[model samples]
Target: MIVIINYGSGNLKSIKNGFTKIGEETVISQDIREMEKADALVLPGVGAFGTAMEHLESYKDIIHEHINNGKPFLGVCLGLQVLFTKSQENKGVKGLDIFKGEVMKIPEEGLKIPHMGWNNLKIVNECSILDGIENDYMYFVHSYYAKPDDEDIIAATTNYGIDLTAAVCRDNVFATQFHPEKSGEVGLNILKNFVKSIPSK
Candidate 1:
């Protein structure tokens, strides 16, 4: 079973529908203990950084435990941002520090603030979650993106004036700045890949 965390700040229904469409079992709950029973956990979010971090404090330790133990983890949008050490937005609020990095706002020199549209991903490294998903368009809607301390952790990148981290994975922990749930077929395939890659319970 997969657990979609519901500490608030996510398009819960759309995320659930995405998994359900792929025929995967999932439960949306704020219960941290439910994570222990999950084959994999997904952190989906949309909104401000500090507020999200505040809500996540209650489950931060458990989330750290889950990812640290190498259980499969997938973060989306603000979900991806919170995996870093800190974010430039929201007065530089601290993140979960799951990976050594900081979130930076996408360069707005020649583009819009919230990169809201489909963008082609430039595959950086190989990972199971991105199998056969290279060069495909994924939906994005965010102002800030993660800049990991380790470039090797970046699974894929997309350009929004400057190359931005689009997807990241370190061991069993995986995250995407784009909403795979709203990216249509390719997006759903990405989620399917994650579900299929989980270690048997």
Candidate 2:
């Protein structure tokens, strides 16, 4: 079964509902044992970077181990940011480092600081999580976005004053800066894609 990590940062209920709507049963837990046995892990968050990292400290190793074992992983919004090395939102706070990258604030060039709205993605590369999703509008709510050291990991981007990273994928790790759970039908489809990518357990 898929486990939605309840690390005291994510919109737990909404994320759970999203998966439920897609007809996928999931477990929300902070238990290390439960996490270790999960078929896939979903990291959904909506909060400050440093606080999220602080709360996630205990589960760091398990998260890495999950990915290292080639298990599916999907992160969203703030969840996506923490996958990088560090975030401008939280100075000096180390991230999961699952992908070598830095999360930087969206340049406020007269545009709103937190890009809160629907934006169509520009697919950059092929990723199983984005199998059938292309140029579709996805709900985004974030002030910072990740800039991976390897551009090849960038799966899709959306224009918000600048071309902000909309999603990223590297092997079993897949993350979305947008909240697919809040993106309506398109979002549900994206979640479905993620579920499909999970190897049968």
lDDT of candidate 2? Answer: 0.92
Per-residue lDDT tens digits of candidate 2, residues 13-53?
A: 98899999989999999899999999999999999999999
For candidate 1, the per-residue lDDT at 118 reads 95
Candidate 1: list runs displaced more than 4 Å.
none
Q: Indicate which candidate wins on lDDT.
A: 2
Instruction: Give Cα distance to truth, residue 187, candidate 1, Å.
Output: 0.6
- Give residue 149's error in model 2 in angstroms: 0.4
